[model samples]
Target: MVTVSAEESLDHGVPAPMRRGEVFTIHATRDDRSMITHRILPEIAVAQARQLNDAGWQVHISELGGRAFKPSEFYQLLSYKRIG
Candidate 1:
């Protein structure tokens, strides 16, 4: 399944600390491959996930839980298998 989520920004390939209300980097991953968008607002992340869903990709949004600093909290999880 494909999963969409957000994470803190990276500096030189290292994760940078984020302040509350800061922008996030969106991550969409399936198996070993990943797609990333940097410095995006939460709404844009959701829109992208929705677009993928509309295009017949099963997408899952990460839920708000685990680490209190989770950037994934910005959007709901979308998960799906490809429709035949």
Candidate 2:
């Protein structure tokens, strides 16, 4: 019997449908209270991150439950920083 780990299964060729609660989190900070946003779509998260970056805030996008097969763990997907 072959036993596949949860992480391996997730990475398999099979495409998993996006769950309703699946979301991307945008974290932005700039010498102030950090702002966090949860977006269900990647495009929206990227847009928000770009906006934050344009406004001089450092931004990063993370997917919920994307790291170490832990539902509570977040895996960073992209990061943005304003360049002088």
User: Number of the top candidate by lDDT?
Assistant: 2
- Model 1 lDDT per residue over 12-35, tens place: 432222232234344455666666
Shift of residue 44 alpha carbon in model 1, Å = 0.6
lDDT of 2: 0.50
Q: What overall lDDT goes with each candidate model?
A: 0.41, 0.50
Worst 10 residues of 2 by lDDT: 1-10
Q: Residues 1-84, candidate 2, lDDT per residue (tens digit)? A: 122212211232322223333456677779966887767545566776777778988777665555221212222232232111
lDDT score at residue 82, model 2, on the 0-100 scale: 17
- Once fitted onto the true fold, the runs of candidate 2 whose alpha carbons sit more than 4 angstroms away are 1-21, 66-84
TM-score against truth, every candidate:
0.34, 0.53
